[model samples]
Target chain A: METKDIYREIINEHNLHPSHHGEISNPTYEMDGVNPSCGDKIKLQFKVDDSGIIEDAVFSGSGCAVSQASCDIMLDLVIGKSREESERITEAFMRMIKGEASDEELEILEEAEALADIAHMPARVKCAVLGWRTMEKIFKENRQ
Target chain B: MTNIFKNDFEILHDDKYIYFDNAATTQRPKQVINAVSEFYRTINSNPLRGLYKWSVKSTAAYENARSKVAEFIGAEDSSEIIFTRNSTESINLIAHSWGLSNIKEGDNITVTILEHHSNLLPWQMVSRVTGASLTFIECSSDGEISDEEILNKIPSNTKLVSAAEISNVLGVRLPIEKISKRAHEVGAVMVVDGAQSAPHKPVDVKALGADFFVFSGHKVMAPMGIGVLYGKLSLLESMPPFLLGGEMIESVSRYDAVFAPVPEKFEAGTVNAAGAVGLAAAIDYVENIGFDIISQREEKLCRLMIEGIKTIPFTKYFGSRIPETHSGIVTFNIEGCHPHDVSSILDTENICIRAGQHCAQPLHEHLGIPASARASMYFYNDESEVERFLEALKKVRSWLGYGN
Candidate 1:
């Protein structure tokens, strides 16, 4: 029997009261990631400082509870961190969701680590990674 | 098709899962399952290859299945039936083959707002290659297609018109006969995506005057890897081969090649003979009870389903609330819950329904919804399933914490 307990109270709490839910007035970088098959889209908007630190980050769009919560949690993690630190955290979170994270990486992913059980549901892994993948895509494009 | 067909389906007897995703695919009857197994066990040979007994026997089974399909849909000739992978491939074949050759720059391709992406995207590509303009005959908010829109959207430059006989998402039965007549008057060909209609009602391509009709076998009762593209014999003969190689060729040399007749020319490579056999068995199973029984049974279930959905104040039914108009599919959204959450909540009860855009993205955009959940019923489904679905649906909002 498959378990449906993936929607823990923490995920619901984040979905209900998302801190990073709206769009930024003006942003340094913006990109949209969509699970084209399932219709989940998260547009990640970020404002970076001159010191290569992310000043503010927000996501806008509609998606499932998990995706909405994941975006909210993802932006909260990277808001005040340097680009270098945010990249490491996002990498750890992605690894954690994909079931490949080490103890050190899981330690870096505090609230986001709640989705670690999501790796068991292969169909939903994309929902947990939409915001992070969009950030990764924008970083690659900016680097190029 | 029969009232007792639930027993014929192995899943119903062996499992407790309630299947409401019939629009995606139906559970196969024991007959279809056994026919496929019998084909593999007895006539295991590459058809249309060798002149041996096994090859001849397999070839006969494949052609016999074609004949059954042609007869099932009221086609005049068996050769008009071209086996494809699924409805998507069948429509793609028409676009790549017929659309590429006939449509030109400055031509217009007309379709309804309710087409599945399978029916919409191929024409999008055809327009791209041919430089043809595309137009849509908008449906009403309740998903009704009127005659005025048909007359208005299809004009002098309209080269080809395609519409689904029934909308997979909205469950709206389009006036294909009316649209086909307008298309004919304007010297345009009519293509009907019968993916949703063929399985639910009696479909006669000639009576409907469709120049081309496409449907998937899996959606009806057959296995995957089998689809049917029914075209007028003249049109199939006029179009170029969608794929060319192997059995599709009459004779071939290094430099030059000659192609076979209509159906064979379109069907390249070794065909899905076993899948065709399974499809024929599925047709036999559905036809055994006939559309009268199927439609009546499904309509009653749909009415019960709609009535149950109406009890939820948060539920917003996307199409006609009247069950007869739905033709057995119902798509809806709860007030404060995302469709994924609605479906996930239902999944905990082992109730299988479809979620997302249902591959009709343009319709969802027009409806101002990001996605919706769908419960598609079939003749095999009973009234208790609908009651259970309603009971589960009512809990969706509360499960997502909408309850105060």
Candidate 2:
């Protein structure tokens, strides 16, 4: 497999200049994502409004382009999404990473479908899912 | 591709790929492979058990392998050598058998930051269990630990000093002889982790004054699941058995048992006789090639790699700048690129390199980085392989969209 298959232009752009790459003020839910195997870490935090809309989502940590870009793109998709909508997208993203999501199911993932190739590269599967897993943990625990 | 010994390894049949993760485990030569199979086909039996012919031959082959290890490392007697699953198990044997019983509260166990987790974590467990303080003897940014550093860190109250002869990540050789001498003066037992050094150079545990020397068979071209631990005869006699079962005991009466002597006492259960035979064959191969020729080739390849990496922009190779100091390992990083990404890019070019903390996270933390990429080499690696690696490494940043 070529490097282009994994590090496409979209990934490079999101990794180089992530929009929601810093912390948010008074986050409602936060979780730390750590890949102990390679030392990639991310602190995922979310700001949710009273009606359960994710107002802001940001992450602060160090990792590779796949991990960093995956987080940035995930936040871009999750922001302005309701708790149920974001949870559906999160499930689709996880399925895509595991190489199990159908095209119709992965439609909600949008740009994150770029990471579908990560399923072939077993080593980076952890990196591609680090942020998503952290977000899943936050949602699973903080459900009202 | 012109490496004279490369043809002996079947894994390198494909010229398009280069293997640079030797510090993790070296590829086994055909000679070692054949010896292991031959042992299984011809002398397959439970060693040191039963009075049958096959059992006798199996016992002799296992004991012969022990003698080969003792001779290879210059141990005074074969009884000093104990076969383990790997260096990690050997080091753990020392920690549980020797460290727990000897080390007490208030005593400090000193080790260098360059130690692999195999050498470090066992001591950490000993400290945690025994109430002993675990201290680190830090190396410089370039992986140098001077005599002054050793003298200052290893005080009179120190009870043990464990260190690796060469750092698996940095590839720089430590002053283990000096450190062992100091440990002796302070009445501390010195344990040398020779997993990296034993494969690359000639080592004399006696001359180094190491009370315990441990190494793995796989890292030296033997099959996995076999390792060697060489301890002083008296020291081995004094420590309790780390594992106890059928082979390690002389007699058992339900609640109480009579443990066997030094080496057998440590070896519990049925041993890996085929793995031992492979290791013995590997030792023969190393001896035939000799360290003089091996060191010269490795140094030449390392210098070529270092000089090539120097020309790459926004790149920094860790450890001493001197090529001779690095046995055959070069760990480096490109600015803004994670080591995991670099390793993936190299994989695209059919090159394999280690991209992690190399089981030495404490050293990575000491170097002020989360992780780094390492390209370690064995004697079979040639200059052509080094050139290919450097060429691929140059494109790593660009492949990740870093501006040239």
lDDT tens readout by residue for model 2, B1-404: 56678888989978988999999999999999999999989989999987999999999999999999999999999999999999999999999999999999999999999999999999999999999998889899999888788998899899999999999999999999899999999999999999999999999998888899999999999999999999999999999998778799989996999999978998899999999999999999999999998899889999999999999998989999899889999999999999999999899888999997899989999999999999998888888889889888889888888778
Taking the true A–B contacts (Cα pairs closer than 8 Å), what share appears in each candidate?
0.44, 0.71
Q: What is the C-alpha lDDT profile of model 2 across A85-131, one tens digit per residue?
A: 88899899888878899988788898888888788899998999899
Predicted model with the maximum lDDT:
2
Cα misplacement distance, residue B333 of candidate 1 (Å)? 0.5
Steric collisions counted per model: 0, 0
DockQ of 2: 0.76
- Per-candidate DockQ values are 0.56, 0.76
True contacts kept of 2: 0.71
* Clashing residue pairs in candidate 1 (N, C-alpha, C atoms within 3 angstroms): none
lDDT of each: 0.88, 0.91
Clashing pairs in 2: none
